[model samples]
Target chain A: MRRALTLVVSGMVAALLGILALGGLSAAATATDKEAANEAKSVSEAAKRAGKKDPYAPVVYGDR
Target chain B: MVEQTTGVGAPPVRRVRDALPLYAVAAAVTVLVLAPLAAPGYALLYDMVFVPRQPLSWDLVAPAQTLPRAVPMDALMSLVTQLVPGWAVQRVALGGAVLLAAVGAGRLVPTERLAVRLLAAVAYAWTPYLAERLLIGQWGLLLAYAALPWLVRAALDLRAGRDGALARVVLAAAPAAITPTGGLIALGTVVLLVWDRTRLRRSALVVGGVALLNAPWVTAALVTGAGGSSDPAGVAAFAARSENWAGPLVALAGTGGVWSAQATPSSRAAPLVPLATLLLLILAGVGAGLLRRRLPPGTAVRLAVLAGIACLLAALGVLPGGAAALRWAVVHLPGAGLLRDGQKFLAPYALLLVVCAALGAERLVARIDREVAGVVLVGLLLLPVAVMPDLAFGGAGRLRPVSYPADWQVVAERVAGEPGEILALPLSAYQAYPWNPGRVVLDPLPRYLPGTVLTDDTLRVGDVAVAGENPRLREVRRVLAEGLPVSATGVRWVVVQHQLPSEVDPATLRDLEAVHEGPFLTLYRNPAVPPESNPPGLGAWAVVMALGAALLVVMAAAISALHRRPTAW
Candidate 1:
């Protein structure tokens, strides 16, 4: 009985973590998330504007 | 467990003397647990929590990069670091993990052995590293090291042929599989499992499953450029380029070797606070554990013997005159070579020393009359616990302000409110920096945990790896180093000092200014440097990989449980 319950819980935890990640990956950025996104984008843009460009130029490299 | 009869109808043995040690251990553990609550800021528990918690790293960088939650011996520190961060959450984590570990140990050993195990844990909990981690809030190291007793249980289970099907072993192996130096403990487990081939199939399943559980980290390392990357002899060459044979050794035991930020020399070892334990290790002749074994370790003594060998190999070097020891010491010991401080060993070695002391306590107790043994062992364990700060096992001190006050979120929000990229001076903050460097940067390619910079960029810890593969990014680093690309280029906010690079100096700071100062922190802002200055790739793939690995583990566990009637013993 205990073993069976543990199995159920393990599945539940994984599923929960998976769905959460998927939600994060797929969902449109929310107001807060977008603010965070903008913050990151600005940091990158500033790095470029400041001459500390994204040394890797990530968008073009291995974008496949 | 071994003493229990297998007959369907046989009544389980019930007796007092047989159970005395366990009860004594429980009573001792209770006292130790209560110590942290009463004392508030004991250093031993603080250090325990600090390393895994990555407290030092936080003191080094910006706030956005801090982890969502803390791990290990560092929980209380993480909480304290953040303004009495709610323990309801961390309490659940720490209590659950520790309880699960105790259950894991209970499955394999007699109550006496379990008590001995707990005794060892109490010793490590009280070590200087743990204390420092606790005070500073290094959750990762705390959880990882706190998981040591269970790893002992794991090793014993493997030896007993129970590794074949123990589900608890899978759960128990969780923290060790996840922490910074986890790979070492896992490697040690593999050695023990290999030593007992009778249960090869079972051992393989258990060990392999545990390793599989680490796939998220391993995959992160791989995708990030670790295992199959150009960094093999690559990055170490750079760290070692300046060092001669004598360098790592002197740095190993001495104060601040190559990585020292200070102008003067100082030994890196922390003053072990549970001083009685240190005296015990030397007088009891533990240096033997380091010298005795070379091949696959056979017994518990041998496993410990090898564990010490591994630490010494990292500490002294494994080769002749500490040569190989220095090499292995630097490369193999989970978080060694990369991070600046050599004192990382303080956590693991101190745990080992404490375990030995616990064993010593067990012996001391066993020798005396029954009534006296319980009293003496509890007294010894209680000494540290009783004085424990809020973070320690038996501490009575309230959580005091570490160099940084506990209001991390405030720091985070304040940094988020800043205009430019900031550098966390002491960059090894916590496990989060490894995952998210945008939150803090000592350098362009965040060193990630206790490893190196400019080296792998793979950012691998244990089996987990986060590949930072962008050849173009490398070229960018070279250019930026020559000089910040432009005013718009340099990092804007620096959480602390000393981590700033040559290029981003006077010219860089001409525009940047400190905007806010907390009780323990100074927030700087460069109105000219925008927040979007240097952005990293969205970790979409890494997230997929971590979730994927976690899924695989859950599946394998379910399938295995159904097929095999793993002896719960």
Candidate 2:
């Protein structure tokens, strides 16, 4: 029983952490997050105006 | 073959309970002794280095799918700071480290006498190496240091074929999730566990338990290509050098000698103070030798040999052959980069020295009355504190924390409504904020701003030779040096300091509009950009691995419980 319980508890904690990460559950970014996001968006928009493609898309590094 | 005489004969849980009062006193004294770290609203030296801007969420965990350093320790610290103020969290965390060290020392030392155990606990908690590390602001490494004694105790229990050894080892191995040093110590404990061939199966279970506890960080490092460094210059700079053999020796006696920031050179007495301090420790060590007969012969010899070997390895850089050997291994082997800070090896040596010193002092005062013996024991306990007054109430030579500038808060509010990543110029990680004169601190920008803003000012890894590899980091640097690039790097806002770089042409920024202008900061926004929608490709893989890791931990825990012995000895 003790061994079984230990397994259950460990499994639950690990699964919970995994779920948290996998769910992409944004626990609501503060005012600061909104500002930082907006700022980056603004820069991407400027890039678009300068004829850049998909300026608002995620910046993927090819080397990574 | 041998009857247990280390007082570890009793079940560990019972032994720990019996010593609860002593542990409490040790913890209380630790907090009192290091009161300066917990001063109201004043942050410790490196609190800002680890403080994340936003609270710890699922996003902090690294696994190639998330940001780097998804280690539990970082996440734990970030989570705590979100609820508690940063300065208070730093103080409590530091205080908790000393308390943990005290408890581990109390539990590990085999002495039966309460006074002797308590004295050893104090010695282990208040050593020169502890002070030097604290002053150097390596709290993550210090967490591992605090956990070393618990590892030793758990290892010994496993060797004795005691019940619940696997459980204890798992509990003690918690530090590994935060710092690799803890993982290294956990490895040593595994070697000790497996040393008893008859108990090989049980020991393997303990190893599995440790691996499970460390899965989050270990998995992250393996998956993310995060660990390893081959920088020769960093190796030279951080490696334990034998150039001054006496430096580490004196440090073991509670005098400072690692980095310039941690080094303490007395002016009035000059060399005499350090020499005298060394002599005093040597005298205590000699006393310990006289009482060596009291220790179980096997345990005493093993600890002594271990201490000697650690001391040798810590000072290996003194010789040309040793230096070459370390350099070779660092370049050829993976994970050997951690040995660059070779002084960390002294953690175990210091533990052994304090235990032995306590035993020696116990014998020396054996004949005295209880009151006088108590006084002598307390004096012995305070010896390290007396030798290093700077780490005591003096706040470790740091002053009170200064509040952030009002302009920063105002700018943060103005930028909150914007979306996408933001960049701050001039991009630097560690800065000497004019508001807090005379102290260097991690840049407060990340803490004040929200969401994934990018800055390369802080070295992600400490003093490692790996050059900055991220093209994004390079593009950001270029954008800072030259004006905003012809192509966008997905940065929506550019926050330029009051004094812009000479090469940066404001006119070159297309569709740029000034949102907020201040004496200290100017915020520019590109109105043409929209909010980011696409997620990274690895996000799904990360979630899957995370769930797999959870299952692995469950299996390991079950194995540990299967090996558990009945409570009755």
Candidate 3:
């Protein structure tokens, strides 16, 4: 009975830890996503204003 | 798999656990080298065209059939992008490649000591070819490069009749998920297998396995009629042009390829020869000399011959008689166009050199005291990073990725439900984006608008253009020369990229209505358009691929299970 109790508690603890770890990972990923979104918006606005040709396009290769 | 020592001075890898530390170090270094990728908002400059905004689909894999180059990696990336953000996927993939190459190279080394294997891995994974290609954005080819060591190890293991060798071969062939280079390597491996008559059964199995792995791309190429013509200038453009007769030699030693000035690293550790690269060259020479005494005579000879052939091929453009030979081969041969960039063949040569250096390092340790050997090995391993710091993470200066304009996102969103084909205007294959100065980004329009079939046939290779028929080309030309007339052209929507050079003024179109107008792009809609037709048998092809991939995974899992059983090993 005592051994069973110990096993059950340990299993619960392990599950809890796993969930916490996963939550941390997701949190980090979310932060990165938000940052990327903000940067994309900024760059897009800049690109709209600049309106220059794609410098890395294949046509440029022909020129080179 | 059981470790079998076929050649002299061979030390067995006791267990898989013994390889873990080296792999860990490799993983850490890989992460370090690509640290810039971990940065927020950065996207790779290369083919982000298929960066997944929506769920993965048949459209993602179908392009392999029609595209000239079968880049299975793009499909894989698309699948990955479904879960991970697009900005992070390239960095993760490249880091994974570096780790894979390191582990694979470590396994190929026949040395007893762990240090030698680790050092060899560093040499193999951190070559000038790797840096140059990564900088140029040929990650698919690099995936194949990373798998080369594993392929060799598996081939050697199979020859020895080691259990689970077939499984290793299957795993190594996984790189076929990215590039057709694995198939090419497998072909060479089969040739090697042919040399040993006793390994005939294993060789046949290896061939079948390789064929199965390569089926998606191979079938696609066959179905699309992909590889026949060669353009002389196109062939010449990618040919390995050495600076001098010894140019290829110097490049292999340290500097880089002879082709593009951009291949040079952003920063130099030394003006002439990076101290680390020179050390590797010296080590390789020493290793070669020791090969006859330490390793099997035949194996040693084969390694030297392979390296020599690679060097010869790499120098073919710049050498006195080489250009003529290369020209002849390109003109006369059927699939010789694939070898246009002959320098890529040097990857195997680099592999052999690393193995040789590892063996030589082992010999040096045996002769000298531990203290002296330790100093020498550590210095050699660290010198590469010291000499070429930019290669560590910055990709020689192109680490940050620029985002597509929000106009692209908005346009893609607007066309999400459209069924008809959308034609992109200023129909140039490659365009330099002003947003990211001096860097080129492939058309992101198709990537943004997943719902529609985007048509632009400006992609070319020398004089031989891509798979657009004369009639279609004529129609496109006419549409571009004259403004889009709704009834004449079948295109439902015309996307005019105002920033690029275009023959016709999109605003001048009479019948087409301006549906959406933005700063950089203008979308015009046609009133009359036909319904979409299903691509013949493409669904069937997708099913076959799905089944084939599932089968491989099942087989691999079964083999792994069998390997785990005590009696089986």
Candidate 4:
């Protein structure tokens, strides 16, 4: 009975951690994706504003 | 009282065998949190700026006009980057902060259980306080966060009259003393923990020594032309912010209420985060009793008082009537502006919380069956990481390093060829470069260039603009607002950065001659102004003397610590 109770509690804790980890990682990835999309959208908008004058290509500082 | 057997006289192999797991766990935590820093370039986030080789200019060592925010930190960075490249220095600093913080917390916990120690290590190192500070690029504060546990341990040892403990206290506080806020925190910790009427002389000596370490910034503040008062608007702008529906006070309770929304981890906004915080609080309460029983006589009460004061300070800006009081104090009281962003003061509370929670876990496991104890311990160990997993891989790649444009080096070379005061145009304090997408960084020109570079000091938080204290910059702004030409400002050179939303009026460049025009930065020379070298004055020398004295204390402490037999630290 004691061994069975231990296994049950351990399983519950493992499941909780797994759910929290998955949720956190998914949210983080979504935030990163959203940031990249916004960057691309801004670049496009800036190019449109510039028309044919230099195309307004900003220098790349670093990459992930 | 809690078996102070920190492997002092244990056999060498046995000590290493016992210590191996703690070190391994710390190493794992460091690697997990700072994985993105393995990349080559510098991570230029908000206030975190790194150049190839920072020049040891007088302005960096002792600010003549502005407040000494960076103070001795910039001076030390300039000195070190002269020998080691800035990239390596950045990596070592960030990595060492994470590793040392974990090890320090793990060692400081008054427990013999390796699992409990490991729990404290993971919890303390992976805290939201460290995460938010690291994300905001306040590496100096993170150094203090890392040094805190060691400082607390040494202070405790000093209270107990342990040999070599005073030296340990000095050595532990040296890294923390690099910045004004960190130095003040270290000083407060020593005074609170080491003060005893019976050992009044020793306590005074230790407190005075830490105060001397803080002297460099204090001396600089006195000599600066910019008066001590700060803008009252900053009190509202830098107040602890609410992360989610839990509000700001609860956020502070969890050690996560940094001012900037951009610096907070996304997982903190989860609805269930407050539940985790509540659980941790309950555990800490349960373990508080254990801590009181285990620590020597009055040590636990002193620690509790210290933690309470830290929490109160962190919540001060958001408390009832707190904002009004802080606003008045910042305007009327000197150096009270430091209390505006009170969330930074939460380091001691976070440390105490983690230690208590770890002890609480130990107490729970003590009553449970062995198998169930293992399961509970594992769960608690994973709790912090599970709740805030976004802190991994450099805050989910927010800390990715980027290389500066060749234009920076080109501009630096020209400025070095002919030393002169240069003005960074477009008049914005923070820049959101297309190159560093989705990140706002302070202008790197001040640190990257050789001579004094004038950048805007006004800080804009969302819609609120807090005024700066630089009289020269204020005058420059006034001239520009009046639509004057760059030549009329009397700055030797003007560098206009392109590709930002802020537009530079073509009329401002009327009387100036364009020097080197890069794709990113355009350098123009003002023929009306001539290059002049200003030698360091007496005020600068006073700051230098203070820095020298602080360095000597640390050196003396190091020699003493190394020579002592059976070191308590």
Model 3 over residues B1-569: C-alpha lDDT tens digits?
A: 12223232244453545767787778866875566666565454444343535434444455522333544554566567778876666666677778888888877776667787788777777777777767656677778778877777766666666667667666666663456654565555544532466666766766766666666665555444334445545545655533333455466545356343334453432444444456666777777676556444465565566567666666666568667776677667755655666676677788877877777777766675555566556655665555455566545335455666667776776666665667776666555555554444556665556543454544443333433322454576786568555336677777877665445454556677777888777777777775463454764385347436735753774578477556665
- For all candidates in order, the CA lDDT equals 0.39, 0.55, 0.59, 0.86
DockQ per candidate: 0.02, 0.01, 0.06, 0.18
* True-vs-predicted CA distance for residue B23, candidate 4, Å: 1.3
Candidate 2 lDDT by residue in tens digits, B1-569: 12122354688787667778767867765764455454445442433354424443333545332223336655566667777776666666677778888877766655667777787777777676776566545676677778778777766766766676656666666664366566656666455433555766776676766666566655555555333434444445554422133454455344234432212212212344465356446745765674466544466666666666667656655445767777877677765656655676677677777776767777767866555566566666655544444444423334244555567666777667655566665554444444444344455565556545555532322222233323466666675467655226557776765432122455655566778787667777756666553353464356446535644664564566566645424
Model 4 chain B poorest ten-residue lDDT run: B1-10
Per-residue lDDT over B1-569 for candidate 4, one digit per residue giving the tens place of the 0 to 100 score: 24344556778688788778989999998988887677789898888998899999999999999999998999999999999999999999889999999999998888989999999999999999999999889999999999999999999888877889999999999999999999989998999999988988998999999999999999999999889999998888888989899999899888899987668887898999999999999999999999998899888999889889998888888899999999999999998988988889899999999999999999988988777788888888888989999998788878877888889899888888777788998887777676776677888989999888899988776556688899999889888889888788889999999888667898889989888898789999888888887898999999999999999999999999988956535
- Residue B372 alpha-carbon offset, candidate 1, angstroms: 5.3
- What value does the lDDT take at residue B536 in candidate 3? 42
DockQ: which candidate is best?
Answer: 4
Q: Which candidate has the highest lDDT of all?
A: 4
Best prediction by TM-score: 4
Q: Rank order by lDDT, top first?
A: 4, 3, 2, 1
* Residue ranges of candidate 4 with Cα displaced over 4 Å: A22-64, B1-5, B565-569
List, residue by residue over B270-297, the lDDT tens digit for candidate 1: 2432243334555224423422231124
What's model 1's TM-score?
0.51
